[model samples]
Target: MAPDDERLLKLLTTAIVNHPRATMKDLAVLAGVSKATLNRHYGTRANLEYQLEAHAKGVLAQITRTAELHSAEPLHALQYLIKEHLTHRDMLALLLFENRPKTPPLENEESYAKDLDAFFLRGQHLGVFRIDISAAAFTELFINLVYGMVDAERRGRAASSRSASTLVQIFLHGSVASAASNLPE
Candidate 1:
């Protein structure tokens, strides 16, 4: 990313983190630029939000790719991604909140969904996830659960009651290989 792009992203992220409901004016002020300048860079509020979502999705995809390289199992890779996301709580909160906008979904959203579906499909093929569940449904469930945990943490609730590892455990509980099903592939 260009230096200006990085600065703009940081400013917008900071504004979102500082306020539950941030506006374009807030981001413009934070970036030390006029609203028109901001608009020139992003076109509109919806466009700005799309850029943010794309940035976040890129971050997630990179993390997932790295985890997949180091981990022996698809589930382990996903667990790593979850833990990394939780570590960046503020960014996740900003991304999650921005995602609720009424605008049409960004291109990055569909790509991200495809990547997640592929991961879930790999897990299902390895008998690590419940095969009965469609890849799309499994992906949606996992993403929603992770986002819910992040929201709970942001709300200052008993967030620590369930760590990312615990969430993964719960997610795979019924689908994990039992004693009888633990035979080597």
Candidate 2:
């Protein structure tokens, strides 16, 4: 990212994370730039949102790719991705709500969805993930569960890593495998 772009993104992200109702003017002030400068850089709120969405997708892709390169199994890789997301809850929450008004198609978005599908396929082939469910469905399930946990944490309802981990374990066993009873104790 260019220096100016980086600065703008930092300001916008911080504002979104810190103040849920942040506006462009708030971002401009936080970024220490004039509104004209912000408009010149981003063109409009829609344009800025598009850029933020793309940036978030790129970040998620990089996280999934890194996990794929290092982890021995698909589930382990997913766990790593979840852990990383949990560690950056503020940023993740901001990204989740950004550009949502004009949501992009899944294929057009650069998120980890495709990589996750591939990962699920691999797990299914390895007998780790059930073949009954479609990859897209599985991906959605994982996302919903993870997002729920994040929401719970944000609301101070869930406060521990153990709670998050347990949620993941339950999710993996219940949805991915054919029988939860078959899972390791």
Best by TM-score: 2
- At residue 119, what lDDT does model 2 achieve? 78
Over all chains combined, what TM-score does candidate 1 have? Answer: 0.69
- TM-score of decoy 2: 0.72
lDDT of each: 0.73, 0.70
Q: What would the per-residue lDDT of candidate 1 be over residues 25-105, giving only the tens digit for each residue?
A: 877887688989988888877777667767776666666666662335876677786888776565676777754566556
Residue by residue across 40-129, what tens digits does model 2's lDDT show? 888777777667666666666667777772335876776787787676565566666544586565443534777777777778878878
Cα distance off (Å), candidate 2, residue 84: 2.3
Predicted structure 2: clash tally: 0
Model number with the top lDDT: 1
Clashes of 1: 0
What is candidate 2's CA lDDT for residue 8? 67
